[model samples]
Target: MNRRYVVHVDIDAFFASVEVLLDPSLKGKPVIVGGLPHERGVASTCSYEARKYGVRSGMPLRKCFQLCPRGTFVRGNYRVYEAFSEKFFRVLHSYTPDVEEASLDEAYLDLTRCRPLYPSFTAAARDMKCRVEKEMGITVSVGAAPNKIMAKLATRMAKPAGFFEVPAGGEENFLRGLDISDLPGIGPKAQVVLRMLNVQRIGDLWGLPRPTLRSLFGMGGEEIYLQSRGIDARPIVTRSKPKSVSRETTFLQDLWDERLLLAHLAYLCDRLTLALREDHLYAHVIEVKARYSDFRTEIKRRLVVMPLQEMGKIYKIAEELFRELFASSRLALRLVGVKAAELVKSRPLALFEPYSERQERLGQALDRVRGKYGFGSILTVRERMLDSVYDFEPRRGFILKTASLTK
Candidate 1:
């Protein structure tokens, strides 16, 4: 049987490391990248020193400062990070054409075909890590295994700047001693539930019957059981486009009035529609997501046979869905979101019949103006209402405007 080899590469403390590279003085000090403490923002990433001080990613800025008063805090620069990621991927491409980017800071490379190119998997991993650190001024950790699951687990075991290899046929042994949380798909809730079922380790899960596990956690339990034994059949797909475009907001204080909620939904639909138009795409499905004070969440979706491009049309559908889903509920809302799915490339000019050439021209003109001046250059009345309600401001960046049309 032919063996499959997978390699996982993850940059160490990506944002914090970039900060260190820019300023030599911050090398050994505790560094934090997040928003201002007064703003309700959370830490994006922090240095190992900051972790020692009990500061972690996703912690509120105020708590981070309370834990480490002297920690250096810097606002995250996403553009710089994006540039670094591009350069890093270039180096990865040099090693294998079968590289799959897991995220901005992590990637997986299939080395089954190129195993003979290097003396061994360990050597290949070492060389890759060295090239990234030397060329990009960033450290990376690598993990090698016969499958993606084992490769991911190996990477976690070799954290804080190191490399590890799980030898062929040794995956189960490698995972046997690890905590249940070490499994990729197991979250805190799953861990608690598993503990209640008297399963404390990854090995313990292997003994449970698949049906019993499925009964407890549904389809996800079956997935976890397979993963526990390093049996992930998911391939690294090259092109994975998003099924939907969405925007969401969580209120610091919950709102109770139905009118106010409807207004917010209108604002979200406007934003989502603008994004859809910018992408040169239209959606046939509109989904509205709402979270109540009791932590219960609901999503209601409606499908249209014809793709919708107008903000008014999309918002009307979303409002109707929301009203139908929450008509009797009087609970305060914690969060609200709007999503557009079932997308297709916009056909401004059609062959089957004559369409509204004037509407298409207007959309193109508005998109050009927004592209040049920024998203705030063009806004509907609903977005203006959002500004009044939330004091929102648009940032300067590549808004998905006319750019998509050219592509």
Candidate 2:
């Protein structure tokens, strides 16, 4: 009876670390990668050095400036980050074909089937960490355990550049003393509810009766109960494709201006279409969403007769949806989002007969240039409207890390 083993690998301060690796002069210093500290954005990643000053990812750039005034801030380059991410995943694939990417900077590899290839799972994990650091010039932490829950938790425990493992039978002992908040599913709201019940630790949750937990949290309580006891039966899915790809931004201040909203929508559509083309996917459905200053939200969607991948087509639909959805209230909005769904791997040429092949060719050409230079190297006039408000280079999504930029 061989035990299953899952390995979770996370790049240390990925965006920030990449910055330091590119420029050794920035190494050992506080690096912030999202944007300038005063910009209307948040930290994407920060070096461990900056963490000492309470600077963290998702913290407002203004607040991060007040916390770590001396920190070096840089607008991150996503293409460079994407390159590094590809290298990182390539290394994982060398060890196991059953690797699951959790994000651009983290992944889970099922080592149960590969145990015979390596002397031990611990050795395999250590070798991976070493190779990543040696080859990529960036450090990573790895966690190995019987399940994904414990594996990810193990990775978190081994931060900076370290490795940790929990033997098959030691799961309960390993999880017992940890805080309830340490579990992946425990959000702030869950924590508030648990704290009210005097449940401060994972061990505490383990001792509660199932009915009591269910009565308090419904189906979520059952999940809390299972996870608290280190019971995750989910398998490593190596081939799961994303259901959708979307991007959204929250304004530093709410705005009623229509032009600015359209500009932002166009930019977001460009980003979404770029990603769709990169993955060789197309969307049959497009959605536009907006959140008002009062927190009221609205969404409008359209189903296209043919799946679309061109940015111009996607943006045009998004613009229509936005106008139609907001035509009545046109409330001042604090946030706006665009999403492409009902994705398909490929579309037939006949389906695109009504659309412009020239535009599609143009999109492919633009992607090639951007792939070589970087995202937003050539911006559309609509996207350029963001220039007045954004000082950092534009990309598909929000900026959240602070690092030194190259070129």
Candidate 3:
């Protein structure tokens, strides 16, 4: 059996760093990437300079401005971010085939089998970091340890372009002094519960009896116990396919008109299907969700016989589900969402399908045109209504804070 080692690589302030790389004038300034201060979104990421003023990822742009008034705000560009993420992953793939992309800027590589090829694990990690900096103009912090949990924790300790490694059997010593919150799966809510028990450090939690901890936290306590002992058995999964793709929007004001809802659903379906086509995958399930002004929410799903990648088919199902769900008690809605699930790794291969061969070819043609131009270049009448409801500047590609972990 292989010696089970994982290497975690994290780009430092990825979104902000890319912005700086594009415009060197913003290098040393407090750069915040998400949207303008008055916009209805949060910071996707911010520079270390912005961190000095207590700004952080997911902080509301308004609040970030309140904290760092002098910071440069950018409406984030996902195309550029995705390009950088590709470069980041390529660097990791050069070292090991078993690399798991934790997020757009974080990855875990199982270098256990390839360790013998390098002089030492640290040397391999340093080479990865230097190559990333030199080739991509981005710095990465790397951590090497026995398993994924310790590797991730080590990366946290070695942030801002640093490297650290823990030999096999030294996981406990490396993690014992760290905060309980630093452990994976330990969130703010878990921290409060642990603090009530005076378990502040990972070392402190390791001293508690498993049953007592289990009584307090149920299954999560068992997980904490194992993690405190640096026991993580999960393997690195390479190029893992996403189980589902979804798009959602929260309204600035509650909306009650069905036409407006349909328009929004149309745009959501278009975006979701575009993503599906991009991944070269199809969805066997379609789902729609809506939240009313009074806080009532409902989600409806439909199972399909054949996987689908066409926008019309997806939108039709989502719209029908939405109508069926809200037909009776349609109130002012604050949010709406569309999702594609039960994904498979290929286009529908059946002899005959819901769409004709010509229709499929047209869909592919439209996708190619949109890819060259922009999402707004080709849109249905209903999707065009999105412009009136919510300024749909397709080139601007708005993204919210989807990453919770630090890079």
**Sequence-dependent TM-score of model 2:** 0.63
lDDT of 3 by residue, 1-407 (tens): 55677889999999999999999999899999999999977898999999999999979899999999999999989998999999888877999888888789999988778866876877887888899889899788888888877888888888889998888889878877888888754646679998998989989997889888768865456567777888766556555657689998887678888887898788788888888878877886689999989876778886553567888878877887888777856588888999997677766644323346776687889889877777677889986665554443456432223421110
Query: lDDT for every model?
Result: 0.77, 0.81, 0.80
Top-scoring candidate (lDDT)? 2
lDDT value, candidate 3, whole model: 0.80
Q: Kindly report which residue pairs in candidate 1 clash with one another.
A: none
Ranking of all predicted structures according to lDDT, beginning with the best and ending with the worst: 2, 3, 1
- Per-residue lDDT of model 2, residues 274-307, tens digit only: 8898898887668999988878677877644356
**Candidate 1 C-alpha lDDT tens digits along 125-173:** 7899999989998788899998777888898888979899999889889
Of 1 and 3, the candidate ahead on lDDT is 3
